[model samples]
Target chain A: MGNVSVSELRYIVGPSSYDSVGSKAMKVKKFLQDYFPSQDYLRRLGVCVFEAEANLAIHTTSGGDLLIVIYNNRVKVVAQDTGPGIPDIDKALTPGFTTAPEMARQLGFGGGVGLNNIKRFADSFWLESLKRGTTLVFEVWNDDSTQFDY
Target chain B: MKINEICKTVDAEILQSKGRLHIDIHTAFAADLMSDTLFIIMRDEDPLLLITGVTNLSVVRTASILDIPAVMIVRGKNVPPETIQLAEQNEIVLLRSKHIMFVVCGLLYKAGIQGVSWEM
Candidate 1:
């Protein structure tokens, strides 16, 4: 059961948000590219979603899950995890300050750039983590006719 | 220098990989911190060579998503067999250079491999 669109993508990752999991995001990108070959915004959307997936896997508990939703007008990525919440939003969102697990650092996901990079490419981003877990949402507006010159 | 040429010149033992070198790179920097490399290196440049001291699955993970095709693990250390296997799985060329990261990067630069203007 997924979103129904002329062309839509929804990816779900449960705690396997490692660097390897980026391929899941790529799968959606490939599907979208089949429809919009020259759409740069869609490409950008893929990059952000990949980062969010990495974030969820690196920071959240193993059973945590991340979801990427691609609709007709916008691509939204939601990463939710039943793991320890981020204690400091400001610092965690910084460009190079990461609290990622050591193993994640070795793989290159926690250069502390995931969120910032996601924010840089995404049109709107919201990250909320409470005692239960963290929920991150990233959206990118896509119309697929021209370049996004902003 | 071309990535293929760099591979030939150094005494780097291929750990895991096989793919045509699609792009030629001039200079490179080696570091364990993905943060430093992300800011310092040019992401768009293909066949960009990265030498890292980090020995973890994340190393391959970062390099793969970033599209870095060449990763040289330096120092006397070696990547775990699984990580090496993983690097191969991802189509990223993993090599073990007997030279330390600093020396390898310096030699490549001295031999005219190249370097992007790194800004702070």
Candidate 2:
């Protein structure tokens, strides 16, 4: 197949945004599911991408932007936000670790698993969080080289 | 084995996914933290029962990503219309019950939902 470029798909949602925060994540999942239409495959990708968006919102900034570009049977997700930054990258990567705000925890988020989840789902992953801000980049090829559960 | 029987055991309301309410629940997952589910979750055919105190659009979003069709908001909390709406859109069934998560699990286990099995 040719490249599936979605540079056109991008949006930003923030703290003051609204009652529901994970809308962007939902949008990405829906788009991909429609584009690929694999019941088993899509949902797992949904969980991974949604968690990434949720972290940027609840941890980094009250708001943020997510860029989803589908290319060459590979999907790339870039999440960025304005926040204090991750003090300890190593600790944050820990599965049980969470720098998430109270609201996130109350809502069952911020347990520091977003990156981990994203890594597990995508074919490849990278992370950067500093005093300035944090950015996470993930890429997954459509070749089913990636598995969801095990 | 049967989803209908599982629902009855948990006293969970079949809010959105009626058609799937009774699907076989070969596996069950319980966690208030989203992180654990993302990494450890491993199984395809096993229908999942997501038990959490959270009832938000994100929760539904998580369920959708995980391809989990059934979610039960425990502690008898009211799942906002938006959350229910999202869940419905994702084709996920949401149930609300007054019982705490721990108690709910006990009942489901007794009712024969073995959580995730090693069989597959």
Candidate 3:
């Protein structure tokens, strides 16, 4: 099927953005579950949303914004953070390679799987980083096009 | 095993049941690392329980997002109020155990709870 935009939503992510700091990720997950496609798409979308949100919260200094665009057969997620870009994109994308602080590690994150998980779950992915910030955009198809978990 | 049964087997305290103690769970995935937990694709027929040493909001978040029915915190780690509150809100059963990860796994295994087999 041809790509057709269906709906779009955006949210700010930071310490003071939500009543509970990390609860925004769950909200995104719930929103997609109710409005987007289901089954494999929901599974993959859930992981991508959580990871992207976690990366924005744990890695960045000033937090970021998450934009979710739902298409006819896919969902595109673009997450952009403010300041202190990744020094090594390659290393950051590596599984088990992490620079997350101990506090984040204790929270079961910063295990270096956030970016890797996003890359694996997304049908197509793109990333850009500068000293000012980092931005990641990826898409997961609604149809059971392929199994990315394997 | 049912959520309540698993709790009794591991000597775990039922921190937050949300009236979900009767739910049957057949598979389990234990990890202190949430990133790894996210990698697992749980099957729908066999409800999964998350066994973790971490007592943080992310554990609850991971379980909630993945549709995991219950979470068992090992080593008797003190779960914060917010984590327990979140779990309750999500309707996810939260459990706490004094046993370490290895021991808890063994106990659950003996109780007929199987480790999750990730579909390839």
Candidate 4:
């Protein structure tokens, strides 16, 4: 992960066509680390982004975009993927529940913790998946200034 | 234990080293799942090592995200060149051992290295 001082960042990640999840996620983590002040917050955000990037890379028919918006009070992340959306969003969010194919399992992914991890880390989380696509949004506060009940 | 001693105990080959032989290691986390690895709680001063049988690039990526510093690939799995390259670029140490994951963890534990604390 390299550092670039910026308020926002976006990158397209895969349909498992390329092994770019780690590198791409690293870049996102580096970008956030440069601006975010809390180590704990950064770590939580890093885990969420890594999981989101992995999901987009492995599950989508076509790769998706990871959009990040950094603000004075909080940081927001949005992950969008095209086609073949999750039929059961609740089941997918359950820990230890996964529909990841064998290939993803072999790579040590699809442990069914991705969405839950995001939900756990983000101060606010939202997700929507239809027949055509899926969109996930979450935000983490920069500090303890704001807290929300999950 | 130090990196060199840990290597000797497991009979590990250093595929990539960042001159980390002398650094003391107090904690480690062993898992084949990158998702579980992400839940490991690592402090800035705590130099953690990752023990996994997985040979994919994501292993390195997970370690990098957690700042785990080094990875010990057990069961002598054939690692991809790109994974090694990524580790090199990130200055993350890579080690390979013929031993299985369980035995490697056992040896390290006996040598005073402890399992990492979890965020959960």
Candidate 5:
């Protein structure tokens, strides 16, 4: 039998809600900072994870769950929402393309680089969307010896 | 420069210092868009500061996440009490300036604070 250890953290983000998103992201950030090798890697991960959470709060109608799983060598983040899914993920991933509302822009988000930023920072990225929702899964490796593929 | 010096340079009112005035910051990024700020800071190596016109909990929250030592809210915007409280809890310095974002950035740049840049 293969034995593995995993630790997980989760947060429920309400759609169109702003206040709780940052706090929840902070919780994840604190947890990662303690284990990640470099503050630089942790900062990059924090921004990507925060963007995912913010996207869920801004785009979805019903909000979503942000899940973080910590393994010995990597951290996996999953942001899933049950809302109107992205119709054009390819276009949506383009830099400076955003559907975030005026309120989100006013809060200094919606620069349209959320997903792009996520892709840039993650060691591996995956996205799945349907009429009901979207789920983004990304992993960041603790070992920084290799150059990032992004 | 130290947080106190930056506050004086911008003529900002120190809303909540959290005893962080002595902290040194070497780089500054001014933007109304937090996403852009977040993007730039992620790649920066020096101690970072944020100058913005948005005065909400998100500003403080973003700084807290990135471990940014201080934030200056430009254009004399009113920062809510809750925002200040969050800053204090995070040990982030929060200040408000009468000058606009552009002017605040200029002042900091002239004061030997370098701007943030991408890692590419």
Candidate 6:
């Protein structure tokens, strides 16, 4: 048999761009479902990716890129945006805290749950924020035995 | 409850169903914030019905990703044709009610729909 190959997917998230985030998320979800072995893992990863993309669309000022890599044992996602970095990472991670504009709230977004949800679903989470941009990296393991319900 | 029953209870109009109104939904979540909705559905195993006054393409996309059976847009909001098209394409049952968010939630609760437990 031939050696198996990994799959990689990437997307560009534009600043203040609202139309394509959902579509990009859908594509990522479908890709995960096709390759991942566990349904629970797929669901969690899907939610995390969706929330991350939505945040990029809402908060970023200079657009960003989303990268997804599917390996034999895990899936990884990195979202990098060129916007003003989050001022208070701790406060921003709070479940109900939000600095989203009134329009975002009115449109059923900016509830301050996006990053929190991403943390809840990701097996490992990392963040880097500066004055110029923010980058988030999260991973989900394919092993079902190690999964925890939260 | 069946989606059809929820629709009847709220006097909702079917914007786009793709013949999925018969799908059973065990829990109901009311939120205009897509992030909150995403959080609840991610943790819950039961079928869900999302009720929101925020009618936007993202709403349909959220339901599709979470595999939510139906979405009821309250306040009789006029959803754009593109949103309706997206819902149809995703096979999500889209509904619109004349009642506001509070009234719609009350009506659904009265009609035997239960709120999602936030235990997680």
Model 2: per-residue Cα lDDT over A1-150, one tens digit each: 455555547877575343455567677777776567666566556666677767766765456778888766667888887766888888877776776667667666666777766776677788888777878888866675554445
Candidate 3 per-residue C-alpha lDDT over B1-120 given as tens digits, one digit per residue, 9 for 90 to 100: 877788789998999979467888888998988878988876667788999987877788788778788999999989899889989999988899999999999999998989897532
RMSD vs true structure, all candidates: 4.5, 3.0, 2.9, 3.4, 2.9, 2.4
Q: Write the per-residue lDDT of candidate 6 for residues B29-115, one digit (tens) a residue.
A: 998878778878444457788999877898988887788878999988899999999888879889999999999999888878888
Q: Alpha carbon lDDT of residue A73, candidate 1?
A: 62
Please, what are the lDDT tens digits per residue for candidate 3 over residues A1-150?
A: 455658887987783222233466677778776665454567678888888888887778888999988877778899998768999899887778998888777667777877887887788999999989998999987665565544
Ranking by DockQ: 6, 5, 3, 2, 4, 1
Q: Return whichever of 4 and 5 wins on TM-score.
A: 5
**Per-residue C-alpha lDDT of model 1 across residues A53-95, encoded as one tens digit per residue:** 7776667665455555656666677778776788989998777
Instruction: Give the per-residue lDDT digits (tens) of candidate 6, residues A62-116.
Output: 8789998887767789999877999999999987899887766767778888898
- Summed backbone clashes in each candidate are 8, 9, 0, 0, 1, 1
TM-score on B-chain, cand. 2:
0.87
lDDT of 2 by residue, B1-120 (tens): 565676678776777773366677767788886655554465667768888887767677667667677888889988788778877767888887789999998998887777653221
DockQ for all models, in order?
0.27, 0.55, 0.56, 0.53, 0.58, 0.61
Local distance difference test scores for all models:
0.67, 0.71, 0.81, 0.83, 0.82, 0.82
Candidate 2: give the clashing pairs: A4-A70, A14-A63, A15-A62, A43-B65, A46-B65, A47-B65, B3-B22, B4-B22, B28-B115
User: On residues B24-109, what C-alpha lDDT tens digit does candidate 1 reach at each position?
Assistant: 77656677876555444344543568788877766666565556778888885857887888777768887787888778887787
- C-alpha lDDT of residue A80 in model 3: 97
- lDDT by residue for model 4 over A1-150, one digit each (tens)? 334344888888868743567677788777776676566667677888898888898889998999988877577899998868999998998888888888888778878888888887788999999979999999887655664332
Report the CA-based lDDT of candidate 2 relative to the real structure.
0.71
Better of 1 and 4 by lDDT: 4
lDDT of 3 at B31: 91
Question: Which docking band does candidate 5 fall into?
Answer: medium
Model 5 clashing residue pairs (backbone): A108-B34
lDDT of each residue in B29-51, candidate 4, tens digit only: 99999978886667878899899
Two-chain DockQ for model 3: 0.56
